[model samples]
Target: MIRVFGMHNIQPLLNKVYPKATTANGVYIYDEYGKAYLDGSSGAVTCSLGHSHPRLIPYIKQQLDKLQFVYRSQFGSEEAEQLATRLFEHSPERIYAHSFFVNSGTEAIETAMKTAVQYWQEKGFPSKQQFITRWKSYHGITVGALSLSGHPLRRQRFESTLEKYPRLKADLENDTLEKLTEEFVQVIESIGANHIAAFVAEPIVGAAGTALTPQAGYYQEMKKVCEHYQILFITDEVMTGLGRTGTWFGIEHWNTTADIVAIGKSLGAGYAPIAATLMTDEILEPIKNGSGLIMSGHTYSGHPLSCATANRVLEIIEEEQLLDNVNTQGEYIKQQLNVLKENYPVIQHVRGKGLMLGVEFDPARKGFQQKLIERCFQNGLLVYPSVGGPEGKDENGILVSPPFIISRSEADELLAKLDQSLNEINQ
Candidate 1:
């Protein structure tokens, strides 16, 4: 039997035997052999409610029965409107005035990129189309999104087609507010802010390992600089938004506002493929006054079924008070991870907020992270291997972002399995 593979790593599938997932519930996925694997990273951090969330299923089914899809340009659905209202309700007031829905995080990011450029064009600055992003960041897989991502390995294959946006190093440490501001000013001075459309970054660098966070007042200073030069500050929150990082939005941790934000992953909670790009009135007004139309959209953009599913996901997050669980259990998990770190010298750093955590190993232990993940899978635990940066070819790590509803006992079980895996790998 010939089997078709998926994604960029097609070669690996040829020789590797993968588990056939028969069922999943809560924080566990079961194979055809009935071997259960604990979902440590929540399926690339998309299953925010874990598997088969009870509340989400019914709403999705109802929406499916009522209306599965709708063309956004021809018609608008109440489901889509409610989703927008819910998003606005959770976001800071008067900041995000519009929401453009798309089917995936990459689409949302691509939308934000186009929105930023077109916003300037609508404001009579056609030359302001250049973007500035950081090194070691992962935006998405599409051409525009790939152009914005600074991950060397991911962009390597597409170097010929990707735009060479001016990049900055994301120095979480050694970056004071002054230095952060200076970096933005330098970029603006180098490119001329009038020629720059946006400055994009993740709130907490995900995929690059979760806790590559900024220093205190860093984002505030950066935002100030962007505002001074009229460059839109676009926060890519695909993995950090919708309560993934202990808050509704990761940028909220810094107490700063973004001109544009891309949201996904937990937005649909793996129930549907959906994402949205949110923007403030300041960026939207000029376009509304000028062209009064947005040129970017997809066929599945604002799909009613997807919007309804996402709205319910948000409602469930609030109703279940999962954010509180995230805070409480996130701290507990980090504590456990730190304890594991002390016992294993290979484990160098444990960093993250809420449930989104990163455990970076000392790179000197070559191939240690991959081996750990393999060993953990055999031991019935699943984790995501993380590559740190351009120099991350040798660096090893894992992202431990679990669902927000993870309980203290479940967190403990996760830690226990991780401890056992680490011990086994160490031996």
Candidate 2:
């Protein structure tokens, strides 16, 4: 097996072990051998519109015929502007007046953090630099984003290197809503409000586990606390945005908004590498009014080709009314998963919102997760196990997020395969 450093020395699947040549469409992936597997998890909750959508190719071709690349530093392109405008239409106007495009989710997160710090500095609170993130969260693999992530296994080796930023673990399980809010507030207070730039979190914790939705009124309370201390609220919606949770933004479920919103994964609908960090006018005012420049720039910051592709995706999503499909199908999947939980002794929990679903196994059932994955694979299904759990143990769960384009028949097929896989595990 080959191992290579991915996003800060994290061991990613190497070419030797995970050989390339593949074909995929909708919710099915095929290897070079022509063995097809149902993409149960949508390739880590990406491919939301499914792989190789017919419309994306023509859109990309059209952009290529016109202009493939343009420097967004000094110039503005119609594609980029149009995509930004569409994104804002879906999100809260107060949360996303200005956007900075990047290549991936981690890049978006890193940009959000830096933007928060810069906004504070521009507001004459240069001391506000530290950030607070919750435990068991996956923000991405970039160093800056990793510093804000709380996934234990992902950060175990990098802790020594990330000591500059103070880390505070918010209780995700034990603490009551008020207690958790107070704990988070105390952490910021201890670091001094003037020194804490932002508090970042996933409104519906995606990678850690499907829709680990916060306690009642938790986020609303947290927002109030941040407002009181003048701290920026940054919501990492890489997996939960784009109508994944029955809403344009998952934070809407709590009736709250963030100062900055990091969105990706589904934005391009697997057609392009595009991610963005959105901020309110308040957050961008200082920089716009002062230097009129953001300190960050990337070679492909707003690549025209990517923007064009993403814009087409946005159009398709709207024209197809996929958000309605997401809500309807998401509710169906949740109900079915709940039925499974009731039937299986090993199934401990069924959680998530919209299409993002998780099925946690009993911790006492050793090797259950691996057994489940192997069974699913043998049955021509593809699913992703939760990251950062006890090795060789059933300490984690599995994600079951298919594309929004999936139909009723496809959903039935997935459920049948899942039932068979679960039965095999029970035996």
Which one is best on lDDT? 1
Model 2, residue pairs in steric clash: none
Q: Looking at model 2, how many pairs of residues clash?
A: 0
Q: What residue pairs clash in candidate 1, if any at all?
A: none
Tens digit of per-residue lDDT, candidate 2, span 296-403: 868999998998888888788888999899888988988998899988978877878888887888877777887888889879888878742333122468888888
Model 1 weakest 10-residue run by lDDT: 4-13
* Per-residue lDDT of candidate 1, residues 86-196 (tens digit): 898899654787899998999999999999989999988999999998876889999899999877778888899999899886466556677667777887898998899
- lDDT of each prediction vs. the true structure? 0.87, 0.82
Model 1 TM-score relative to the real fold: 0.96
List runs of model 1 lying over 4 Å from the truth. Answer: 1-12, 389-395
